[model samples]
Structure formats: C-alpha cells, structure tokens
Target: MKLYYHPLSGHSHRARLFLNLIGAQHELVEVDLMAGAHKKPEFLALNPFGQVPVLDDNGTVVTDSNAILVYVAKKLKLTDWLPDDPVASAAVQKWLSVAAGQIAYGPAAARLITVFGAGFKPEEVITRAHAVLAVIEAQLSGGSFMVAASPTVADVALYSYIARAPEGNVDLQAYPNVRAWLARIEALPGFVEFRKTPVGLAA
Candidate 1:
C-alpha cells in the first residue's frame, strides 16, 4: 500500500492515524502541496479531485478520506469501528456526515486557509468554526466518544481537525468537554503527534 499525502492536511492525518491504529504497514509518499504536486497531471490521474491522502493499495486507489476510513475500518479492525445494526450504523453516519460537512468545511478548512494562505476572511471562518465546535461540544457532553462509547471512524475523522482548531484561532475554551475528548484521543495508543499548523517549512 502507498499513501500519497501532505503532512499538514487533517484529512491525511486521519487516514494516517487510522492506519497506525490498525498497525497496517504501508509506504508513505509525501506529495509537496506547496509545489502544486497534487494539481499536476500525474497526481490528478490518480485522483480526479487532485487531493492528498490518496491510498493506492496495489492498483486500487481510494481518494476520499471517509471512504478510505470505511474501507480500512471494515478490512482491518472488522467490528471495532463499523457497527452492525442498521440503527446503530445510522447513528455512526450522523457523526460521519458532520465530520465531512460541518467539521471539514468550518474548522479544518478554516485552519488551512489561515495557516496555508488559502485566502478567507478570518472572522467569518472562525465564526463558522465555532458553530461546528458548538455541535461537537453538545455531542461530547452526552457521550464518551463522538459516535460511540468506544472510538469509531467518526471519532478518528474529527479528532485531528478539532484538536488543531487553535491553529486557526478558533477558540476551544468554551468547549471543555471537547478539550477533554481531545486529551482522551491523545492518550490512546498509536496516536501520533501532528504538527498543527506549520507557518513555514522547518529546517
């Protein structure tokens, strides 16, 4: 298996964390997002969206992070991340939807725009981020984990971006439950430390 990714991308980080959680060995291929490597013909051919976090398992390529999570969770851990009952699975879908929709757009993208020169109004983005965080805070107040009592794909999906919200100047002060959840996630074995927002390349 080959993972084409950028280190700073939260989506890519989720995939990496999931892979690590399951102890799946794979070669890491860093794609230079700064150099427009993802937008180039070669990379676009691999994923039409020209996105990072493309997993090429032999000849099989998975582009979307959520899809890759489902594939990996089902294949690797079996019963751990994915639920069997239809109602329980629907419950999981709720968080997954929030992860891709609210979490991705507001918090994750806001952080990228602020940190990576993606160009967006800071106040506007931060406001949107807070709204997303509010939802998570409410959810965290009720459960030990976002989607389940135990960690699930939904938790893995949102953990990186939510934990790194401070990089976007999005305040976590109001959401103590979420902060606690972040700490819990960090304490989990195989959780790799991620560089939240690298303003510039390190020497």
Candidate 2:
C-alpha cells in the first residue's frame, strides 16, 4: 500500500496518524502540491477530487481521511478505540464528522488560507475556526478524549490540525481542555508527527 500525501495537509495527517497508531506498514509517497502535481492527470486518476491523502492499498484507492480511519480502525481496533456500544459508536462517528466538517473547514482550512494562499476571507476563517476550538474545549472538558473515555479514530482524525492550530493563528488561551486532550494524543506510542510546517508559520 502506498499513501499519497502532502506533508502540510490536515486530511492527509489524519490518515497518516491512524496508520501510525495501528502500526500498519505501508509505503509513504509524498505528493508535491505546490508544483500542481495533484492536478496532473496521473494523480487525478488516483483521486478525482485532486486532494491529498489518497491511500492505494494495492489496487483499492481510498480517498478521504475519515473514510481511511474507518477502514483501518475496523480492521485493528478490537475495542481499543472504537467501542462496541451503538450510541458510543455514534458518538465516535460524530467526532469523525467534526473532524471532516468543522475541523477541516475551520482551523485546518483557515490555516491553509492564511499560510498557503487559499484566499478565503481571513477574518471569517479565523472566527469560524475559533468557534470550533470553543466547542471542542467544552466537549473535552468532560473526558480525556473526544466522544469516548479512551482514544479512538476521533482523536487520530482530529489530532494534527488541532495540535498545529496555534501555528494557524487561532487562539487557544481559553481552550485548556482541548489542549490537554492534544497532549494526551501526542504522548501515545507510534504517533507520527505531520511533516511540514503549517502555511503562515513558515519562516
């Protein structure tokens, strides 16, 4: 299996984190986004969306970071992260949604725009991103991890962007719980850090 990804992409980070957590072995292929490599015909054939984090498990092309997490955790969790209860399962699903929706669109996207030149309205981006931070802070205030008593695909899915959120200029001064949760994930074994610096934080 070969994972095609850019170092700076949050979605890509999610897929990478899950692979690392489960100790899955595969080839790591770096995609050069800045050179318009993702737009090329060959890579587009791998992922029609022209996005990062395309996992080629032999012939199976798995796109979307959250979907990759589901595939992997299903194979490996054994209740380690993804529990057995339906309601708790639903909660785990919700966190995955938050990762793809709120986390991707807000802090992750905002950082891309501010740092990578996405050109979205900067103030609007930061404002929305901060709103997500606020909500995550509240969710985590009650538990060590989001949506479960222990780490799940939820933590791996959301970890990279939130951990790197400070580089994107979203304030974390009031998000103590979220910060603590991040620290816990960071402490986990087999955790792989995202390879690139976030966009604006580049010096």
Candidate 3:
C-alpha cells in the first residue's frame, strides 16, 4: 500500500496513524502541496478531488481520510479498532462524522489559518474550536475514549487536529479529559505523531 500525503495535513496523519496502530506495512509518498503537486494531472488521477492522503492499495484507491481508516480497518479485520456490532459501529461512525465536520471547521480550520495562511477568521474558528472541545470534553468524561475503553478509528480521526489545537490558539487547558485522552492515544504501541509546524512556518 502507498499513502500519498502532505506532512502537515491532519487528514493525512489520520490514515497514517491507523496504519501504524494496526501494524500495516505501507509506503509513504509525500506530495508537494506547496508546489501544487496535488492539483497536477498525475496526482489527480489518484484523486480527482486533489486532496492529500489518497491511499493506493495495489490498484484500488481510497479517497478521504476517514474512508481510508474504514478501508484499512475492514480490510485487516481489526474489529477492536472498528467494531463489528451495529451499535458500536454506529458509535464509531458518529465520531468520524464529528471529526470531518465540527473537528474540521473548528480546530482544523483554526490551525489552517496559522499554518497555511488560510483566510478563515481567527476569532471565529478559535471560538468554534473551543465549542467542540467542550462537547468532546463532556463525552470523554464518561469513558477513556470516544467510543469505548479502547482506542478506535474514531479516536484516530479526532486525534491529529485536537492534539495540535494550541497551534490555532485554541487552548486545551480547559479540557482536561480531552488532554488525558490525547496522552492515552500517544502512549499506545506503534503510535505515530502528527507533525507539528514550526513558528512562522505558514506557507
């Protein structure tokens, strides 16, 4: 399997994290996003959407980060990371939606402003980040993870942006449960980190 990705993208990191957590052997193909490589024709053949983190398993391609996670989990039969039962599977799906929705517009958008010079309003996105964190903080109060005692693709989907929320100036200090959850995921075996941008490194 080959994962075509940009290093700074949280979506890319999501797929990479799950692959490592499950011990899936794969190659990382870095796309030069800063140079418009993702929008180029050759890369677009892999994903017409021109997105980072497109997974090519031999000839079968998977687009979207969360979709990649689901593909890998189902392909490997890693039921613990992605459960088989309907209720538990639904629970995992719920958080994956949150990861793509609130987590994207919230913390992820906020960070895009700082790290990528995105035009989103800083105050607005930061506020959105805190709002979602509050709910996540509440959800985690009852359990170690978003779905169950063990980490799942739900956890992987949410981990990258939330872990780096401070880069967007969205303080994690207010969310202790959220902080603890991040630590727990980091402590897991075969965990890979989402790369942090350096100060003044916006491109």
Q: Which candidate number maximizes TM-score?
A: 3
Local lDDT at 94 for model 2:
89
Model 1 ranges off by over 4 Å? 198-203
Tell me the spans in candidate 3 whose CA falls farther than 4 Å from its real position: 200-203
**Model 3 collision count:** 0
lDDT of 3 by residue, 1-203 (tens): 99998889999999999999889999999999999999999999999999999999999999999999999999988999999999999999999999999999999999998888999998898889889999999999999999988999999999999998888878888899999999999999999988887632222
- Name every residue pair that clashes in candidate 1: none
Candidate 2 C-alpha lDDT tens digits along 42-110: 999999999989989879888988888887677665576777789888988888898888887888877
Error of 3 at 182 (Å): 0.3
Q: What is the C-alpha lDDT of each candidate?
A: 0.83, 0.82, 0.93
Task: Looking at model 1, report the run of 10 residues with the lowest lDDT sum.
Answer: 194-203
In Å, residue 142's CA in model 1 sits off its true spot by 1.8
Candidate 2: residue 178 lDDT (0-100):
84
Candidate with top lDDT is 3
